[model samples]
Target chain A: MDDATRVEVAASLLEAYRTRQPIEPLVEKYAGLELDDAYAIQQHQVQAWLGEGRVIQGHKVGLTSGAMQRQMGVDQPDYGVLRDDMFYPEDAPVPAGIFLAPRIEPEIAFVLSRDLTGPGVTVAEAAAAVDFVLPALEIIDSRIRDWKITILDTIADNASSGGVMLGSTPTRLSDVDLRLAGCNLYGNGALVATGAGGAVLGSPLLSLAWLANTVGRHGVTLRAGHVVLPGSVTPAQPVRPGDTWTAQFAGIGSVTARFGQETA
Target chain B: MAAHEAGHLLDPGATVGPIDLRTAYAVQAEGLALRLAAGERLVGWKIGYTSAAMRAQMRVDAPNFGPLTDRMLLAGGEPVSTALTQPRVEPEILLILGDDLPGGSDRDRVAHAVGEARGALEVVDSVWRDYRFRLEDNTADGSSAAHAVIGPLLPAGVDLAEVGVTLIGPDGERSEATGAAAFGHPLDALGWLADALAAQGSRLRAGDIVLTGGLTAAVPLPSGARIRADFAGAGEVSVRREAAVPPSRTPADTAETGT
Candidate 1:
């Protein structure tokens, strides 16, 4: 896969993802054509997004959950970049068509003030890198058409990222247990899911370590001012127009997002 | 395609929304309730908390499981078009049981009357609007399983012992580190799944399609590309996507050499 070919493939993948189409097996097929070409396509695509002024806001670690790792047949988790433009204010109504396919989930989002990376990054070191913690709702949407994709395709698709919603309130990392913080989800006034910060790899900070080391091993470093959606505090739920969702954290408080027409 | 078509059990007329609830687990429960409300059958459950690394990554101590309906299964070696749902490609080992492994099944006796094992792909799609999701959200998002693309069945001849097979990527780079990437072997993973299911009073039947997690790391397939996987003796399976229109200003990813 030449650079042009890589870019073409990546562009097509992003388009396919946006339209809910399938592209992983196809991307893998191209993988056999060239290694450098394949990676070039991935980097090129993400960099293009960055170039477009989509501030890289946070990072998402897929297959971070043990169950996901087994199901995907990988030992470690894979990651994708997150951008600031994708962030939604908690309780804001979702604009229609902002994502190829969107779903709602309760997650712990960490605000990092310092850069962290290494071949020897530890959980303790990760904890020190954080600036604050907040309740977050991940509006997960995939660019794939039918939601059918392989893990590698997802990695290239930026982990099926769409947008995130953060609670208005922010708490310092030292103010909460981080791991012991609890979360509960409510949909349309009904309690739907419940979990703790520990559910996301024990602590959102540890998840940061995983991302820092994982990406660092690949020669990528996590920059400061980036937010990390460690993982879902609970399983994800599907959303529709006119639906109101809220995620409540035991200590950190909660955030809410509404959904409606594309412009809403 | 296989006998089943993979799709969201959500009714076409049903309303969708962001499960503003606290956790994705709630969303999953809500979805399951909706499925029950719509009279969709719960075929079986998928296990997500199967890897220690993943469990550690998400800060959990055990694996998690989700329900798989008869609707979620696709034919073996199905060619997924590019215009369908957002799809991710992952190679897996599928298990067909010869007997029902009821709840409380012992790990040692899990090998009894196993029918066949085959390489498979799990096509995961998030029901969210813009493919944005978290691990917990997706996990509760029915493990992000909108459908599945399974492949030709490998006979029971190949067990865990022959798992030293090579995984050749699209770039012609061969990697032999596929061992235990999904818990050593497909059957071993299946065994764990069966035992786990048994504990929930759900048993593996003679015809249940159990996707034994990923065989190799997830590979990205671009439009106009095809993926081919050749097992030592288990045979090979492939899939291709039609050309996709380029995305506006795509990213650049360059892969280097070695290993």
Candidate 2:
């Protein structure tokens, strides 16, 4: 793809994200677009957000598990940058109008006390770098209309990352065996989905390590004090207005997000 | 611990896990001491993770530095062979000091102390498996120091605040960046390194060559790949990767190896 078109597509996606409007799949317009082109487009959008004063809070690893990858119709996982504006406080009302078609997935978030970089980072090394871990609910909303996305399309859409709500309680790694940390998602007090941390690439640490090493190849570092959201433990559940969801994790704590009525 | 692992091309395990920044640096110093005992001469230092984006990602308020040795310096315009586990290249400005500047030197003094600046490429290879590790792991691993190639040096007075850098590989993969990508100005990296060294009881001396942080993200260099970096005004440098050589068995190789 030519540089100008790349920039234009990125600008259009950025506009769609900012205005909370969904657009047609980019594959329809940019034929034979490769993964590199998708990432380039994503980077341009991220750069645009940075130019607009949006601070990078952290990053997210998406589609790490076999189920998520299968559900997403891709063989490999993808990553996305998280902005501070994308965060909603625990138990806070999530505005429905700000998203196109929102879905929620339970995840474990790692807060690092030191910088982590890789091309060769191991799971043990990644686990040892964690300052703490918390339960999180990731609200993923694809900018592509109807979410008809290929790997390239989703990657270009920032891995469908929309909003993140983090639990307040932080548990140290020594206090919890992440692989055994079971999680149950409840909507309006009714159980909807069940999973465990092991669902995320056998362990969330492995997922985090995978993200660190993959992004590190592109010259990105997972910094100290940064919060990294590993892939979902449970499949994403579609969110609707007036729906209140809670995710309880064993050993780790629980978090809740309430959706408000959509406003015009 | 890092020295032991790097010397043997081994991965960190029980002997050394992800450590705190302070412990990591201490381990790095110990590794450097071992290298010194083995007859490797320290030429200068290499500062890394200086860009705001990188620093922010690493959650570090400042950049980190590692020792540069004589053996790691490659001749300009030559084919460089590396046995590093996984290697990547970055374009940067090499600061060759003409005068001594200890810690606490101001910007003007730092500018005056520099003898010349050259376009350079640094080969960074992490010993940590999968290139994943904490700050201390990187610090202890000599900040992923592997090899460096220096270009023709330009006068110290050249305005480098906005020098453009473009790295191109034989396969036509390209990445472009500016000097500002390295801590706003490359000299700022020099100053940061000086201060950081001073805090650790070391000092930047004359004849030391400092490689400022990468202006662009590191690019993987496969065997037989020719890489060229063009630095606007400062000139250009190129290096071709030679075919890999099979590893020879050593005493360390026969010993207990950690993954």
Going through the candidates in order, what is the number of backbone clashes in each?
A: 121, 17
DockQ of each candidate's interface versus the true one? Answer: 0.02, 0.01
Candidate 1 RMSD to the real structure: 20.4
For candidate 1, give the DockQ: 0.02
Q: Write the per-residue lDDT of candidate 2 for residues A1-264, one digit (tens) a residue.
A: 977888988988888877878889999988968888999988998898899899998999888876567776777788999999999987569998888899999898999998899979998889888999989999999999998988888899998999999999999999976764557677887656555676677678988899899999999999999999998876789999989998877668789999998752
Worst 10 residues of 2 chain B by lDDT: B1-10
Cα-based TM-score, every candidate? 0.48, 0.50
- Give lDDT: candidate 1, residue A200: 59
- State the weakest 10-residue window (summed lDDT) of model 2 chain A: A190-199
lDDT of 1: 0.62
Among the candidates, what TM-score does chain A have in each?
Answer: 0.88, 0.97
Across residues A63-112, which tens digit of lDDT does each residue of candidate 1 receive? 66554666777666666777777887655577855566678778778788
Pick the DockQ winner. 1
Highest TM-score model number: 2
